[model samples]
Target: MPRFISKSLKKVGSSPGTLIHVGEIKTEQSSLSMLHFDAETHIEQPLTDIGEATSLLTPDATTWINVVGIQDIALIEDIGRHYHIHPLTLEDILNTTQRPKVESFDDYLFIVIKMLEHDKEKDSIVSEQLSLVLGKTVLISFQEDEGDVFNPVRERIRKGKGRIRSAGCDYLAYALIDAIVDNYFVILENVGQRLEAVEEAIDSDLDADILEKIHTIRRELIYLRKQVWPIREIITYLQKDGAPLIGEATGPFLRDVYDHTIQVIDTIESLRDMLSGMQDLYLSIISNRMNEVMKVLTIIATIFIPLSFIAGIYGMNFNHMPELTWRWGYPAVWLLIIGIVAMMIVFFRRKKWI
Candidate 1:
């Protein structure tokens, strides 16, 4: 089955705000981590129990709660209850197939986006749903798996490298989003390299495998576009809607992320166009090859037509046939056939048909 289609049959009859997990269980066990940081202080620790989330929340500092897995329904519900996150929002968090979007609530901003990575070994893109709940002093991030592209953001927060340490939870959220967007460029670069390789293969060798490669890349781009296109709107909403959870200072950064989204979308479109053109070029090349073969066969059959007719006329059983009694009949017929073939070859060459 195509990876783009999510199996949601389990949710067909379920009520809204149901916490049923809809996608693959990428992680075996769910884990939680809390990072509390301010300008001069930074504290990071893993939480063994959900009850510890309340004790770890520092009212004076910004808290980032990272949930590594979402398969645990009770854990998600506990977090939601503690943070006062909407049940619908929690449902979106558990359902990995949620579209990239941002919802503004009275207490928090619910944002869902796909974190994409290019798997080098598989030569394909792997996606995981990342849901962020940005509140006044705390930001909760829920992921389908443990690994993510947010390591650089974590490094910056830990090292106090930039204004992030001095910023609010909104800015921290922006930093995380920025990291995800920036990694998109890396993924695109990898895709561009793949496209270059495919193009070179198309030009140098018309292997049947090249078509499959083009289709694979094309499908990946389409899936990427679906995952990314809505992000533009999400950023636009964050920047322009002036959500209470999104600070005014973070607007420009969201705009920057919006620009990156545009670039990603444009690159996706350009690559898709290239794939379409390559597909057409491949089919045309195959058609021309087939035409060449048919032309050769047609010419051969044309050359043999007269020879077959001549031989057939002399092949009659009539004893009075003049050619059968002639001494040079077979040789004369051979010469005539050769002359006709040569003439046809010259004619075809003049017409540029061979």
Candidate 2:
């Protein structure tokens, strides 16, 4: 779980220093960076001073300021001041647990999305809130941590590989969102592979560990859905909203991003079904195992039932018991017991319940 810190929104002429934290706080500190690029040149730097970076915002070139951490209230205030961001917007930024949303203002657009990264070492998905403020000439991004999911986007911009450099802030925003969505594919693929492996293990035998693995994967998928579902709503809002901030040229591209979101949703639904099936399968396999155990116990019980009866009859010290005086009677009774056991074994074999 992550704790969203409270932000004081004094400058927006609303409540002064109101205490509100909207999101989960899984980590204590966040990282920050910036990427400024245009059609010709691109620059990336780790920003320490908000004022200096704010001064660097230019109308002629596109700027992307990436904030990895939002724990410091002062830093958030400084950034808000630099961009003339609304108090409510700043509050939302600090409140990292916001649902995915897109808000259009007179001068810019604010967007919140979840960035999901799967840690192979931990075998878990690390979800962090990614906030984007798309202005006319700059696109500022706030993240919960410093992760390399955007490396491909950075490289694409660096090499001028696509329409990224030529596009405006809206397109840049789309590119970043699209990149994150693409990473979801990677995550799904990994999960799918692990699921296949689990299926194989389950088919081989119902091991205790397999259930744990199935449950772990299922839990991760549930978390992934929590991170991804809201993003779809956010993108859909951006697409349908009649906002000047989102360019007309970016509509088709945003649609592409929406499709990816849908794909993610579909994959999640499928995984959920698979998880349910796996649980049922585990139950059935366990039941089958218990049945086998019970079958063996029942066979042993059946063989002993008659033997116990015969022994009880012989043990009864009665004057009318003539077999006690006959020496061959004991051997005959032993043979009878052996024959009963053999017949029961053959009957069990015929029923294929042995």
Clashing pairs in 1: none
Candidate 2: where is the Cα deviation over 4 Å?
1-32
What does candidate 1's lDDT look like per residue over 154-183, in tens digits? 999899998998879999999888888888
Every model's TM-score: 0.96, 0.89
lDDT of each: 0.88, 0.81
Per-residue lDDT tens digits of candidate 2, residues 93-176? 877667778888888889888777778799777778888898998888877665647888888988999889878788888988
